[model samples]
Target chain A: MEFSSKLLENAVNEISQLPGIGKRTALRLALHLLRQPKENTHGLSKALNQMVDDLKLCKSCHNISDTELCDICANPMRKTDVICVVEDIRDVMAIENTASHKGLYHVLGGKISPMDGVGPHDLNISSLVEKVKSGSVKELIFALSPTMEGDTTNFYIYKQIKEFEVETSTIARGISVGDELEYADEITLGRSILNRIPFENSLKL
Target chain B: MEFSSKLLENAVNEISQLPGIGKRTALRLALHLLRQPKENTHGLSKALNQMVDDLKLCKSCHNISDTELCDICANPMRKTDVICVVEDIRDVMAIENTASHKGLYHVLGGKISPMDGVGPHDLNISSLVEKVKSGSVKELIFALSPTMEGDTTNFYIYKQIKEFEVETSTIARGISVGDELEYADEITLGRSILNRIPFENSLKL
Candidate 1:
């Protein structure tokens, strides 16, 4: 769309560069910023600049943090021997909210997708293997998604640390608690049947 | 959603302050920005700041501009006496793209919405009236939306300038071009029928 002012055009162009935002949405957002207090824009700009400049990643888990080591890694209460492997910080947050795992997390940054030119080396795999090699980590849980890329990354990481004496397991796949069995996908339903656990085990949760 | 880093949380909060963006979308956008090169964030921040700091509005028409007068008002070839009154610059751009109107525009910024606590005094209506009182304007076309607030705004401006010698009109409302008659809403269909022009007059376009 044609913009009356070059400054407006530039702002919209930069905003639309974000994923899922189009030119129309960018225009709406730019206009919204224009209508708001100048301090609002300043705050947004300052926050964005500060984030890009000062944000750090945990040296141990590769999750985004404000310090060298993330809070989870620095905490003494959480189990350090059992590390949950996931794709990124979003997954880390999701798992943390559930409070189901008492161990630390190893954020791989992203899945190893050959289609996207992301290989094993592109992720945070070597450091995880290093943790296992140190003989401190007793168990590594593969908490990646069920996608092909997720499985590939899981297998690749398992192979790298297989020689080390460490227990490895994957998160269970099953029908959602409230979902109807008829609506479940065939693959998931079949897997749920094959991996069925004792009735008492379900009650433990 | 929980953010591990304060800087990340701040960025997401600021971004979510924009219209229609929620916390999850803001987090996604913040992470996407982090994945991009540092220069991209800098560029977006700089553009937003520059737009808010240096953008100007047209002295004559009140449309957004980079200078004292907007490009439309600055152009000597366009008719100066005919003014199309619109709610904002977006409408001006939309009408301009159609290549249907060659007159300049007077942006009212917004409509009169009592529910939203907006009144005529809150808009650029006074400046528009001042332009009409100057007697140079030969016509004023109301191009605001057909909403109740838009109608109230149009009526308010019309009462302010009815004594002037200028001709006044509103943009026609009808079934949109290429729209099926059966699918058209009752109000629009009824209005289209009531305001139908002669077949030969329609052919003139």
Candidate 2:
């Protein structure tokens, strides 16, 4: 349907491109934005522009950052020897919220989803293997999702690091399935982290 | 939860302020924006900034426009003599989508809702009465919702214009009830407009 203006229609189209937002919801969002004060709109626009201009993927961890290395990767206080591997930056946030995992993180960007054309090459799996090869890390924790793609990625990473003396483990997955690690409640994810199992043990079971 | 970066969190917060968006939805939207090309983000940001910078309320009709008068009010093909009075610019768009109405529109901003502290003065009622008094307009069509506040506003405007030579009427209420006009499909709204009744005759009946 035609809207109040072309600009409004454009805004709605942009908003509807977001996951879970339909045309009617997009229109509602557009109208809400239109009713907001000028400063609110300006703040939103400025924030978006700043994200585009200033934000970058951290070279070390692949997490979003303002500088070359993300805060988690650059922090001297965090344990660099214990590396937690996740599918995305959101998982980093999820693990960080518990304040229990003091280890560093490696964001693989995504899992091995051949159906979606995402392969191991598309992820940061090589960097993760290189990190293990450095011999400094004592433990490699797999914090990937419990889904099939997550399992595939975890198995691939484990196989690459099997020769290393570093301990390789996957976070417990009984609590979450068929969902992103970001959506898992903090408590559940924290418990899962605490109850991790060795990759070989999981395969044996 | 601690996120990848402060800027990403800020963007998520701003997006969540839009109608019907929650934390998860906002995060999904933020992730989508992050994945978009630099040009797409720039275009979205520019559109938002331009919406705040360029749009203003039409002084005569109160419809949103980049200029003092909206396109409909400025168009020579539209019948200036028959003004379709609506609660807001959204209603004008709803009517415009029908492609049946050939008249100009007058937007009242909102209906009179005393419980919500919205009074007659809060609306553009005075400008509407003045337009009718100017004697240039031949008809004033009230395309308000079928709610208590809508009925109240319509009656108030009708009473103000009854003394003038202008023909006063209201769009049919067969398809809607109270604030539900925003949800009404286009065909229903169009049919309602076509079946409008004379204000004086409806009062007598």
Best by TM-score: 1
Q: Residue B64 of model 2: what lDDT?
A: 80
Residue lDDT tens for model 2, B1-205: 5676888888889877776678777787777788777677778777777776677778789888767777888899999899999998778888998787899999998899989889999889999889889999998888898778888998999888898898877775566456588788887788778987688986884
Q: Which candidate should be chosen as best, given DockQ against the real structure? A: 1
lDDT of 2 by residue, A1-205 (tens): 7655667767777766667778877777666777778788888888887887788899988999878899888999999999999988778888898787898999898899999999889999898899889898899999888778998999999999999889988776555547798888887788778977788996874
Clashing pairs in 1: none
Candidate 2 CAPRI assessment class: acceptable
Model 1: CAPRI class: high
Off by over 4 Å in 2: A3-6, A175-205, B115-117, B175-205
Model 1 ranges with Cα > 4 A deviation: none
For candidate 2, the TM-score is 0.80
**For model 1, how many clashes?**
0
> Fraction of true contacts kept, per model?
0.90, 0.61
Quality of model 2 by C-alpha lDDT: 0.83
